[model samples]
Target: MNCRGRVSPGTAAPTEERSCSWLNPWVFFVSALVIKTAFVTVCLVVFLHGSDGQYKTLLQNATEWRCIPSMSAGKKESWTCCPKGWKRFQKSCYYLPADKMSWAESEQNCTGMGSHLAVITSEAEQEFLYNLAKGAATNAYETKYYIGLSASGNGQWQWVDQTPYEKAATFWKPGEPNLLFAEKCAAIHIKGKTDSNTYSNWNNILCFTSCYRICEQAVKVV
Candidate 1:
C-alpha cells in the first residue's frame, strides 16, 4: 500500500517475499556455525586446564594411553611403566637388554625381572616398536626383534601380561610357525640387507639363534 493509503501498484511484493524466504536458511546456517565454534572453544579451555598436570604425571609414569573409540568399551584406561630400565610407549612398556640373550633365555630373564618378551598388539604398537628398534640399533635393518609369549609351548601363545591372544590381531610372516619341527618362538622378519622398507617377510633366515632380545611388561596401572 502507498503511504497515502492508496492501493499499491507495484507487483514486486511477491518477489520480495520469495527472496526473504532464503534468509531463514542462511540464518539457520550461521546459527549452527556459531554454536559449533562456541562448543569447540569451551572444550579447548577445559582440556587446557584439565590436562595441565597430566602431561607431567605421564612423563613420570613413562607410559601413555590413548582412547581407542573402536576398541573402547566406554571410557579410556591407563597403563604405566612396569619399571626402570624400560622404555615407555603408549599404554605399554618395553625393554631392550644391554646384552642379548637367546629368545628362550631372554624370555626367562624377562620373567625373572618381572617382565616378558615384547608382544605386538596394535599397528600403532607395531610402528612404535619398528621405529624404536630402527632408531636404537645400528643393525635394525638386519636384526629380527623378539616378542614375549610365542605359540612356543602347548601351541598356546599368551601375552606376558596374560592378555588374550587376540588371534585376529597377530601379524605373522606367511608360512610362519611352519611349526617347522617345533622351532616355535616368534620373531620379527628381517633381511641381512637394507632396503627402502623393513621387509615384513622372511627369506630362509630364522631367529638370530645368537642373542639380542626385547622384552615387555604390562604396567600394573593402579
Candidate 2:
C-alpha cells in the first residue's frame, strides 16, 4: 500500500498517483504568454525590415504589387503599384502593345491580361493616352490605337467596361461617329503635327479595323 516513490517486485505503480506538475494552470499560462510574445516579436521584426525583407517578399509573391511612398495633405502615404512593362497614371496602369488587332480582338487580349481596353474618361487621361500612342507609333499620321468605345448601330455609344457611356467624357473628332462608313468602334488617332488637338482626336471606325490597342487596369493595393 506504500507506493509513494517505489513499486514492489512485479507490482505496477498506481496510475492515479502520477506526478502532474506540468499540468499546473500557471505553467500553461506561462507557455501561452511566451508563445504570444515570440509571435509579436516576429511581427515587429518583419514590420521594421519591410522595405527589404519578409514584408516585401509577401507583397511581391502574394500580389505582385509594391508599396511606394507618397504624400497626401502633407502626410506620408503609400501608392499602389502596377506590374512590369506597364505605366502608372493616377489609380490605373496603362499598357500599349505594339501589335495591331481588331476592336474585339484587342478587347479580348486586354481581358486576358486582367484588364480592359483603355477607357478615356477625362481630358487628362485622353492626353496621357494620346501621348503614349504617339510615342509608340511608327507613323504618327496613320497610327491609331483602339479604345473601349463602341456603338450598337442605334447611335448610342458604350464603353467595353460599361462605364456609363453618356455620363463619361467624350473626345470625338468633328463630325465623327458618322453613318457614312457605319463606323461603330472608337480609336485615338495620332496626328503627325505637334499642334494636333488631343480632345478632338478620337474617331469611330469599323469594329474590324486593325490597330494598336491601349489596355488599362487598376493598381493592386498591398
Candidate maximizing TM-score: 2
User: TM-score of every model?
Assistant: 0.52, 0.67
Taking all chains together, the TM-score of candidate 2 against the true structure is 0.67
Report, for all candidates in order, the number of backbone clashes: 2, 0
Give the 10-residue window scoring lowest on summed lDDT in candidate 1.
198-207
Per-model CA lDDT versus the true structure: 0.60, 0.80
For model 1, which pairs clash? 117-148, 118-148
Candidate 1's residue-wise lDDT over 190-210, tens digit each? 544353344343221234465
Error of 2 at 202 (Å): 0.5
What residue runs in model 1 are displaced by over 4 Å at the alpha carbon? 1-84, 152-156, 192-208, 220-222
